[model samples]
Target: LIQTFEKNNDATIRNLEAWSLETGQQVYKINLTGAILFVQINTDNSKMLVATNDQYLRIFNLQTGHEIFKIKNQWSDAQKEVTITPDFKEVISIYKGNNLIVWDLEMGKVKATFTTDNPLACYTVSPDGKTIVAAEIFGKLHFLTLEDKE
Candidate 1:
């Protein structure tokens, strides 16, 4: 399953669409509020993570289009990037103040936080989900290895 977003007019329509490659059919669609900044599907493709301009990261069940939970930004700025771990246990978000936060999906609590000197330009989790590479606005890239908790 593949997911994509669509924009309508000036409003950022958060359309979570799942397309079938075999038949070219849209199997599922979930519309969310706020201007979406980022969207990521869990490794198992059961859930989706969406970051919007409303300073919140929301999780939704793709199969039922039901929202599972949302992580509201504690700071004044909104989240810039978000991704889910391959194990589908955690969600990582980079806030506007260069704050990197790891959230436990099931527990609904922050697992860890890292402060950076420069604002984050972008970030990507490694395919194996053991590491994360984030680029700062000053053009410096930082690599972080995630520790296994259990």
Candidate 2:
């Protein structure tokens, strides 16, 4: 499955669409109130994570075209990137100040926070969602492991 977005003349987001690459048919479409900064589809393709410039992250059900949940950015800065965990149970995001946060979808709260010394250039989560690898602009890389909190 592939997803695409359309923008208006004002450089604002107009809509988000999910398409089937093989059939070339749209599976779902949703209107947006803010410009999208990042997007990620869960490994199972059941849900989608959308991060917008309006300081919000929204998760939607792909099949029903309904919003599952929306998260307001806690920090004042805009989110630089976002990704869904492999298990489809969490949303991970990197903010402007290099703040990495993991949000538990079921709990509707932040599950963990990792501070970085420098601004994060990019980040990737392991397939099992147990580890996160973050890279900085100055050729520095940080590895973080998630442990059960009990």
Candidate 3:
């Protein structure tokens, strides 16, 4: 199992802890440079993606506890949500509540960007990885199709 450790007073995340479910022992403890805002495990569970207060996205190897890559978030907007694509080749994130960003994992660069007029509250990609459904803060939902063309 995976869990986050935090200080009681400020309730800020301090580190990430992964424990063995079978042995009930601590597996690894990864120190964080900043409070973790988002955490995601890839499909195979070998890699972990974490977004922190430092405005960077970090990918780590779960078994070795070593960093695989890091991507600087260029936008100053707050990251609302993040997810690894079904194929684990890209990262899709929503920033500033309306900006959708797709980052290529291998290149550690932004692959595409899209924006909506209204502030988005949440979003999710279809299982087939060809569409996105985003809901506005005011409850309006928008359905978008994903394409690779630039």
Candidate 4:
């Protein structure tokens, strides 16, 4: 698994970098000023999606160690979760611990907002985007449809 060890940087992230899980070789690195909330490897393995407390879900080119796209939030709300679509084209994240944000990975902007009975503490999406299974800490399951949630 490609894991992001949150740097000790309470103010500025100093030791955040990428490493290959199989070989343990340094893949790439970057600088940041907040905690890493998410890291997702693309299907093609060319890049990864990173969500930081700085409110930017950045797509980094693994080969060059450069950011290709950045989705910056207009509000400084605390970003909670980040997930990249199976096709590696859409970026989804959570805002205010309750709002689900669908971001166009290439455009880096919000495309949709979904509301649930409770905040989306954790969620999983099928590769085909047909089933979205989510769970909160209330010991219940939240079923969602295309237009309405139940």
Candidate 5:
């Protein structure tokens, strides 16, 4: 669950607070240097990932409040549009101005990546978790299959 403290401008006054649904205890607190672009709470509610205008991504342990991972260069677009997999095991972040990266949460590595030919319209993952498709300008689409990953 997410609770926000608002400033006079109606922007978030401070870092957002993450709480447990059952007990309502503070699980994590996330701060942003700039506007937050992407915010995700994992399926099990054990992890939360925050993406921001700072071009940084950080993963925190919901229970212990420890930072488990931090990554940059995962997304490059100042547009700051990112989507997390429903299962919370994968992340799809696109910074179309420079590149695109799809990451594996467990390994914390690039499962696949590609540079854009032109500006990107959008990106999507296959329902089975095996493929990623990105739509680009001029009605072009790129498909990357991960079913054969070793």
Candidate 6:
């Protein structure tokens, strides 16, 4: 899958395209709002989580191209990256260069937050969704463990 952007004078428009690597042809395109920052498809390829510059985290049904959930952000910094747990119950995002946010997919609310002094560059969730390794711009790695408080 490939994501392409179309720039206009007002806002940056985004188009999500699925391509065929073997035939080198475009399969289909899905038009989306705002500038997309990160996209993460679920393990089953049935759903996707997209984070955009418009400060919205959207979850879409990949098969029907229908939006399932939309969560708006209150912060100012752009989202650096986003990932979904294997169970598709949680969405984790890194932003503001120093903050990590975990969102509950079903409830459409923030579940937890973590902050660091250094700017974060990237992150990945463990296969079991129990741990997160976030890399800082200064070459430091932070390992975070996720727990169910409730």
* Model 5 regions lying over 4 Å from their true place: 5-14, 20-28, 96-98
- lDDT at 66, model 6: 72
**Residue range with the least summed lDDT across 10 consecutive positions in model 2:** 73-82
lDDT of each residue in 1-150, candidate 3, tens digit only: 666565545787858888888888888888887778778888788988888877788989987678998988743435646777787777787776678888888899998887888877888988878787888888888887767766
CA RMSD of all predictions: 3.6, 3.1, 3.0, 5.1, 3.0, 4.2
Candidate 4's C-alpha lDDT?
Answer: 0.65
What is candidate 3's TM-score against the reference?
Answer: 0.78
* CA lDDT, every model vs. true structure: 0.77, 0.79, 0.79, 0.65, 0.69, 0.78
* lDDT of model 5, residue 143: 87
Q: Ten-residue segment with the worst summed lDDT in candidate 5?
A: 5-14
Each prediction's TM-score versus the true structure: 0.69, 0.76, 0.78, 0.68, 0.76, 0.70
Instruction: State which candidate has the highest TM-score.
Output: 3
Which candidate number has the best lDDT? 2
Task: Work out candidate 3's RMSD over C-alphas.
Answer: 3.0
The segments of candidate 2 whose C-alpha lies over 4 angstroms from its true place after superposition are 1-4, 18-28, 74-79, 136-140
Candidate 4 displacement at residue 19 in angstroms: 6.3
lDDT of 1 at 130: 83
Model 5 lDDT tens row, 21-103: 78978766666565566567787878978776667677888666578997774565456667666667777777645366777
Model 1 has how many clashing residue pairs?
0
lDDT of 4 by residue, 1-150 (tens): 344564462544444577778898877667765566667778777887777767767788876668897767632445455666677766666666666666667777776777667766687777775455667657556654332124
RMSD of 2: 3.1
- Identify the runs in model 6 with alpha carbons over 4 angstroms from their true place: 1-13, 17-30, 74-79, 136-141
Alpha-carbon runs more than 4 Å astray in model 3: 1-9, 22-24, 74-79, 136-142, 148-150
Clash-forming residue pairs, model 6: none
User: Candidate 1 at 30: error in angstroms?
Assistant: 3.8
For every model shown, the clashing-pair count is 0, 0, 0, 0, 1, 0
Model 1 lDDT tens row, 1-150: 677777878856667787887889888787776677777777677887777777777888876667899877543444455677888777787755688888878887888787789988888888888888888899989898888677
Looking at model 1, residue 138 earns an lDDT score of 94
Q: If ranked by lDDT, best first, what sequence of candidates would result?
A: 2, 3, 6, 1, 5, 4
